[model samples]
Target: MSPTLSPSPFGTAKTLVLKVGSAVLTNADGDLDKGMLRTIADWTSERMAAGCNVILVTSGAVAAGRSALGVRDRNLTISQKQALAAVGQSRLMQIYAELFATHGFHVGQMLLTAGDMEDRRRYVNARYTLEELLRRRCIPIINENDTVTVDELKFGDNDGLAARVAVKMQADALVLLSDVDGVFSANPKTTPDARLIEVIEKVTPALIEQLCPTSQTGSLVGSGGMLSKLRAARLATSAGTHVAIANGKRPGILSNLVAGKFVGTYFPPAPTHRSQRTQWILHGRVSGTRQVVVDDGARDALLHRHKSLLPAGILRVVGTFKAGDLVDIVDSAGRLLGRGIVNYSSAEMDLIRGHRSADIAKILGAKPYDEAIHRDNLALFEEVTSAR
Candidate 1:
């Protein structure tokens, strides 16, 4: 039997991340839709009046950039696109500032690159800034620093960016406003009989593979489609944030979504609490400099007994990392097993590999502890598997 769908605890959410997609905020001509902006601003202001802290992640800089530069060509190079973003970001923010001010609300702009979250110190600092803004009752309007990000570091879309923001802020809910009503069984344009999936309790690998196949041409300014939204929903929901994908073109959509109107597809939060540190590791926000591949014995020991990883079980070590740097754990077949902070460096582990705990000091000429990754610091992928 399918699990019953339930509304997230209303008015209990202290912090919310509202993600407005490019298609929702811009017209086919790639111009900002003032009417749509006003509706969103008004609804958000109402929530703020009710004492709910809101952070907005918006897309449209590229669109704004295109309009500002008077570029009608769709095949602009990355450099040209970046140039447009530089010009349009400020213009987009100006519109937001003016619209929000009319509702008597203060807003702050925060531009981030993927690097910001990849570095542990920067991650903490970003969280601190957002918290400070919320404490001061100011809305933080966040967007990816497209002008600075290289292709590899780019979040690819605001939906993924929003998920990262939600994880950073420990937000209770993430509302993704897009052009479509919600996620459907198939691409709505192609499959006229496609049915909307009203609620999702869990996103399985199979379900992830079943995401909409057709890509909706984004507003001249944005770069995401419904598939990106679903991917974002999966990421956010896995991090323990309730996510809703709704139509941004609909009137008062944000308010209606939060008011239990069931306006769009809702991805329910994971039933367990994922420790913040674990979430960061699992999400790959912080890149691990090293990796260790374990055998079946080590995998079983870690997954079933919650045992510390010993040198004897490690088959290979990849990359150089410090003692405290997060590292990936993989199996013999090369699939990622999990991640944990290593107690020894790759150089140190190489000498100690396949050795017993008693031989640690004898082999390395020194020792901190017998285990490579203490049981306490390790989180297994089996936990997620069992949750399913």
Candidate 2:
């Protein structure tokens, strides 16, 4: 039987990150929706005055630029979209500055990409920058660097960005503000009787496949869909951050959320809590297609004994990856054990698997310490096989 979902008692989340979608940021003419922006700014200011930290992950730079250029090219190439974002980003920030200024608030613009979140050094630097902004009572407004983010331009959205940021910052709650109120049992447009799922206990592979059958496109200006939001929710919640998918169009939605009013579908954070570094390892991007499958003994050591992965327990190495890169560690059955920075490359791993630590120098003619993945660099996931 499926587990019943219930909302956790999250009393006035102190640190909040809000992801406002392109639909809410732009109007019908593919332009920036200043009125809506002002409304959001107003409530957000009120929340700030009440001593709540709010960081905005916004969308609509592309649409803003296209509207300014009067370019109605629906079939825009990746280069074209990048050009548009380059033009619109400044204009978008300018407007955000003006609106936020009226409430005696300052907004800091941060243009990020997927690559920034993958490299540990870059990720740490970005977090420090964000922390400094918040320390000065400045609202950090973040968006994808679409002008140069080739991968993101293909299909990524701020929804994914927001999730990554929330986990990195260890935010108390992440509110995804979009056109729709929340995730539904089915597509509301086609399935008239489809009910809104008010609470999601856990997001599993089966649940995602059941609801998001065909990807639903966003507004004329945006590209993200409900599927993206669900994925975002899953990522954030796994890192022990509460998530809510609420309607941006709903009047006083921000105020309602601050007041603890029921506004959207809620996803309670999972029980396990992790340190900041652990959060990064769990969510950090894998460098290559490489996966190191460990034997049963290795899996036991990682999951229960809290030991670093050893070359002796590795059954086989798959794909190619260099040392110091992030890679997935899996069991022989293809179940993910964890992910971490590898101390050995796939080429080296091939020769070292099932070998004794003392034999490393004999085989490779050198040694670079022991342990394929050190415990300090590894992070176990919330979901893992039960201990035998």
Candidate 3:
């Protein structure tokens, strides 16, 4: 379904996920931008007074670490970075606690790693904790657990982390606060004719490629740039969450954006589905295993409409996957058809390969069912792809 572009239904949204980029929250020397944080806190407090639930995903642990260590070196070891994060996290929370308390608002710190989201049970638990905190009228401040997260398990940036948080909580909107005003037709400073994209109705693959080139890099303090922000917007919007990319430096921008003032680049919400199950299958989790090759019939059944994957249509299964594991469905030529949760382990499926539904019990000794991957557990990855 095509998403529609329009101003947000003002003051109606209950929950908002605000992502503050490192560049906006930290200086070139990797010091925290105290004034900017105060502005954000004050604005968030006003929104909370208006009965809005605000969840902040902030990036600055590394920057704060650098500042604490008085290190101006561009190339710091991973251990050094982790040490900095450990030292700076407490100081960062102290600043936030002070700022929010001054406004008579209670704040809670939540540190997350990729592992938290990768496991389904842990993900649900984390969501419950955040929801309870919001229910108690306490703002949840989230940051990557940099002290424990190495390169592999890290989210790589706050933009991606915030998007995951929005998806997890089923948030109403995602506001990405960055240094720039919004998405531009071209590099704003270099291209004089470049204009700001006011509204993005749909985030297409072409748009993703344009905003995020393959070699694009981020600032020393920041990890992702407009590319990551665009991907985050696409992810959130597809899950029926409205997104806005705006300048954090602008005073009162958060309030303006939330009020549907058309402050920056606004991405409209996708069609909302009543069933969270369908939504989760369509967009919630990423596939864990590699591609699963199927025949054209299987591809048509899945893409054209909702249909359960049958073993008869299965061609090949790549990757070592377990029962109930998420795997990508691909065509005979290796194009991604969609993603679905397998009912049988890879080993079992290998033995049952190309077998009829009637012979499943004989092949595997026991059968979950005729279908290898059920339709209910499958999610399609058809949205904009990250150029990164």
- lDDT, candidate 3, 1-388, per-residue tens: 1122334543467888989988889865668999988988998888888898889998877778778888788676777878888888888888999999998988899998766765567778999999999998898999989888775223355787798788888888889988888988876766798888888888866798987676765545676688878888887887788888988877777667755674588887777523444444444444355557888787777777668888888888788878866677778987665667788888888788788888999877877687888877776555412210
Q: Which has the greatest TM-score?
A: 2
Provide the lDDT at 202 for model 2: 92
Model 1 bad stretches (over 4 Å): 1-12, 152-155, 212-221, 286-290, 319-323, 344-352, 356-369, 382-388
- Candidate lDDT values, in order: 0.78, 0.83, 0.77
Residue runs of model 3 more than 4 Å from their true location after superposition: 1-11, 151-155, 272-275, 282-289, 381-388
- Model 3's lDDT to the true fold? 0.77
| lDDT by residue (tens digit), candidate 2, 1-388 | 1122233333366788889988888777777888998887887787778787888998888988998899987789999999999999999898889989998999999999877888888998999999999889998999999998876777666888899999888889998998887988988878899988888989865688788875665555678888889889988898889888988988877766655675578888888767777777877766457799999999988988899998999999988888888889889999887798899989999999999989999999998969989999888776673433
Q: What is the descending lDDT order?
A: 2, 1, 3
Clash pairs, candidate 3, are: 281-379
Q: Which ten residues in a row have the lowest lDDT in candidate 3?
A: 1-10
**Candidate with the greatest lDDT versus the true structure:** 2
Model 2 alpha-carbon miss at residue 346, Å: 2.5
Clashing pairs in 2: none
Q: Per-residue lDDT tens digits of candidate 1, residues 86-133?
A: 998999999989998988888999998766765667878999999999
On the 0 to 100 scale, the lDDT of residue 228 in model 1 is 70
Error of 3 at 139 (Å): 1.0
